[model samples]
Target: MPNAAERPRRIRVQRDGPLIVEGPVEVVGEDGEVTVSHRFTVAVCTCRRSQIYPWCDTSHRRRRDRRSGPPGGEAG
Candidate 1:
């Protein structure tokens, strides 16, 4: 097994989506507040629309579908 210090943390990025990171992870907000997750993997929000800040709740997907407009590029 690789030593914890020698192992690199993996993070997966998605276009218009959350960043998938290997955990357990700690996130510090602008206010100096810390958010911690102990899951095997975690989704960090990037679009800032998640009901649960820092942790993604797939809110970006909902917004993307709405902004794509209807068929033939017409938005009503």
Candidate 2:
């Protein structure tokens, strides 16, 4: 078996927050557009209203709607 230190990256679900992703991950938009990014940390956009795209900018704090997936491109 491989050592834990050499394990591959994976995605972890946060109890009430964005999905915690490690290692390699791909992100796509509503139009099926793909984004390329390389970083240690990122908060994905679950509300689908973030102008920043695949990343979360905490816009969900004020969104009246909290539906998963997409919200017809509406911020709230």
Candidate 3:
């Protein structure tokens, strides 16, 4: 097995937040348009409520509905 430093970057899925990833990254839209980010790290939103699609801006942290939990909710 490779050492920790040699391992590839990971995607961390937050139950109530963004999908954390190492950048620079490109997210291609269905319309054949590509959104690019060049930061050292990126937060890809899972919640459909983001004002900025693909990239996260902490919109998931709000309480939109009482019936709802986190964006994707907790994983067993």
Candidate 4:
């Protein structure tokens, strides 16, 4: 835990992306579960597409537009 005199941690909110937070960070879920990361920095998933919940695996970058068919522009 940080002391009262310690500076507040910084969290950067990326548009349509994960939240970049300075670590080590402790995340508490709605289920009263806790997720901890000791990395110097962590990307917290906001899109909820990551297989690893609460941790960003760049899944948001893989999002495909339904109207655009597929990556190769193949309509199936």
Model 1 CA lDDT for position 40: 89
- From the highest lDDT down, the ranking of the candidates is 4, 1, 3, 2
Clashing pairs in 4: none
Per-structure clash totals for the candidates: 0, 0, 0, 0
Q: What is the per-residue lDDT of model 1 for residues 1-76, given as tens digits with 9 covering 90 to 100?
A: 2236358889998877789999888888999998988898999998899999899997776665655765334321
lDDT (Cα, tens digit) per residue for candidate 4, span 1-76: 4434268888998876799998998888889898999898999999889999899988876785777656555311
- Assess each prediction's global lDDT (C-alpha) against the native: 0.79, 0.60, 0.74, 0.81
- Candidate 1, residue 3: Cα displacement in angstroms equals 11
The full ranking of all candidates by TM-score, starting with the best, is 1, 4, 3, 2
Report the C-alpha lDDT of model 2 over 1-76, residue by residue, as the tens digit.
1224366766666533466666345676668887755676656766666778677666665554455545454433
Q: Candidate 3: which pairs clash?
A: none
Task: Judging by TM-score, tell me the better candidate of 2 and 4.
Answer: 4
Cα lDDT tens digits, model 3, 1-76, are 1224455777887766788988777777879888988788999988867788888877766745667765456431
Candidate 2, residue 31: CA error in Å? 2.9
Query: Which ten residues in a row are the worst by lDDT in model 3?
Result: 1-10
In candidate 2, stretches whose alpha carbon ends up further than 4 angstroms from where it belongs are: 1-6, 64-76
